[model samples]
Target: MNTAWIYLILAGLCEIGWAFGLKYSEGFSKLWPSVITVVVMILSFVLLAQAMKTLPLGTAYASWTGIGAVGTAILGIVLLGEPRDAVRLICIGLIIAGVLGLKFLAKE
Candidate 1:
């Protein structure tokens, strides 16, 4: 809703991008994917730092990681043929709940 939150969300998205880039990069062996991964990784950290300027450190960090973990897991399932068992889905749902709680219930 605010600029800091926006930055955090964008950072989370960048986190996801970099995660995929890491896979595509093949352990940094690929040129373009590795470069893109590094760039996105830097962007993610910068945006996260910007968010931390206003957000409480715990909330910001947890929410940022929560978004990244959830996004990456879902994408892994969809794109990389990862498992999609009920337990895994349930765990992901719990993570989503925790992230939403941090966003809406956090004082700042």
Candidate 2:
């Protein structure tokens, strides 16, 4: 795998962490989670920018956000007790497909 792809994946993971941090932060009322959220958000953006140095902007961004969205949605359902509807699950599958398509077809 390309270094940029690794960075992009790391960026996506960090994005997930940061998003969860936001939820855990409770509207920034809690200090620790809020601070962690800021740190993770910065790391995610930094990795994303690094990935953009090599990857196509549109493809990289779409993949990054796709990963974040899918991961977050799963976490929401599993960890946060969000609803698990059929339509939402199917939409998530489509997103996964699109992300996989971009990953396989995209050229470095």
Candidate 3:
């Protein structure tokens, strides 16, 4: 329930949104989506910086990137009809486990 943790979670959510926006941008052909994606991505980084004010930079960055990758991949599979093979699922699970392990380990 730490404020830094909340900020990190918000940053992760923003990353997911930014990723979706980027996909919708279609090489920036869609002006509004592309602009929104850029804005959201910047906001996400800003939030990450805020979180890093208290959290260790390496830990915060690793968690952020790990969660972002997992979330975006899951979103792609669910929303975009991307493949969900066993190997892909296992990889995603490993990413989640690694992120969780990092979080727990950092607490002590």
Candidate 4:
């Protein structure tokens, strides 16, 4: 695996962190959560930029956002008491499949 991919994956995870942080921040009213949210968001974008240096922009952005969306959705269902319906779950699965397809088709 390429170092850029590692960075991209980490960035995606960081995006999940920030997304949760934003939810917990209550519109940035809280101090620590808001701070962490900003920090992690910056880190995520920086890592994504680093990844874009090596990978195609379209491929990298798609993978990055796909990972973040899937992870955040799952976490919302598990950690945040979000609803888990069949259609929603299936859509998430399709997003995962799309991410995998993009990865398989991408040139590295």
Best by lDDT: 1
| Sort order, lDDT high to low | 1, 2, 4, 3
Q: After superposing candidate 1 on the true structure, give the runs of residues whose Cα lies further than 4 Å from its correct spot.
A: none
Candidate 2, residues 30-101, lDDT tens digits: the string is 999999999999999999999999899998999999999999999999998998999999999999999898
Which wins on lDDT, candidate 2 or candidate 3? Answer: 2
> Please, what are the lDDT tens digits per residue for candidate 1 over residues 37-96?
999999999999999999999999999999999999999999999999999999999999
TM-score, one value per model: 0.97, 0.95, 0.94, 0.95
lDDT of 3 by residue, 1-108 (tens): 688878998898899999899889998899999999999999999999998998888878988988899999999999889999999999999989987887787662
lDDT of 4 by residue, 1-108 (tens): 788889899999999999999999999999999999999999999999999998889889999999999999999999888999999999999999988887777667
**Full-model lDDT for every candidate:** 0.96, 0.95, 0.90, 0.93
Error of 2 at 34 (Å): 0.4
Tally clashes: model 1: 0
TM-score between model 2 and native: 0.95
User: What TM-score would you give candidate 3 relative to the actual structure?
Assistant: 0.94
Name the 10 consecutive residues with the lowest summed lDDT in model 1: 99-108
Candidate 4 lands at a TM-score of 0.95
Looking at candidate 3, the ten consecutive residues that score lowest on lDDT are 99-108
Q: Top model by TM-score, which number? A: 1
TM-score quality measure for candidate 1: 0.97
